[model samples]
Target: MSKKRKRVSRRRLAGQRVLAHVGVHNIETGEYKPVTAARRYIAESGIVPPALVNVRRNEHTTDRFFWGEKGLFSAQYAEENHFLFPSLREIVDRIGEENLFAGLEALASDDWEEMEEYEYAFV
Candidate 1:
């Protein structure tokens, strides 16, 4: 007789503000793809692939992150495309932890004033 395995629910990723919206970077080909639509597609399919690497941003702490099957819980996929977590982490680090969200959000939303308010030299 086979023992029954217990199933646990891990869907607690809603409502958390994702400060950095990173894309899927193909390390080998130097290609990058946005992860929004692909994430939607994966959600609808119900099958998670291993070869994806997206950065996992901490809601409260932007300096901390991890790597996993999906980009939400951890970093983006890596099995298929060469992993780019370290490099990505470096980029984030250069941007500074305190200003990570403010900087990225400003650029993503085209809110230059926000950056200016932060006293970012870029603005």
Candidate 2:
């Protein structure tokens, strides 16, 4: 059974990412040497990862809980689109984990499982 607990106020879901799918087109035979090369590029370029940007101003503010990295927005795109790493682990690692759960006394539900999954997932 799901246990009910007091809801914690969060600005947004932790480790949320704005996914940007850069489409690919068929190029010359020489350009697409191996199909797997594209996969390698995706893995390395970090486009697939949850790339985050601080959005909030007043970097000195102490009350803010989350990193205020503003994301890049195009005039054509919707405002809801934001960027983040592929998972929470990356976000925590990028921004010190200490800040993430600093005030919380107890760990959140699924915290352990989420961490485990993040650890095993490929880069």
Q: Which candidate number maximizes TM-score?
A: 2
In the range 66-103, model 2's lDDT, one tens digit per residue, is 21223222212211222222343444556664665454
Clashes of each: 8, 12
The 0-to-1 C-alpha lDDT of every candidate, in the order given, reads 0.32, 0.32
After superposition, the stretches of candidate 1 with alpha carbons farther than 4 Å from their true spots are: 1-21, 24-84, 101-123
lDDT tens readout by residue for model 1, 18-95: 223343322221122334433444455553333233323333322122233335433312211212334333444666
Which residue pairs in candidate 1 have backbone atoms (N, alpha carbon, C) closer than 3 angstroms, thus clashing? 51-80, 52-76, 52-77, 53-76, 53-77, 54-75, 54-76, 54-77
As a TM-score, model 2 comes out at 0.25
Off by over 4 Å in 2: 1-13, 16-91, 104-108
Error of 1 at 113 (Å): 33
Score candidate 2 by lDDT.
0.32
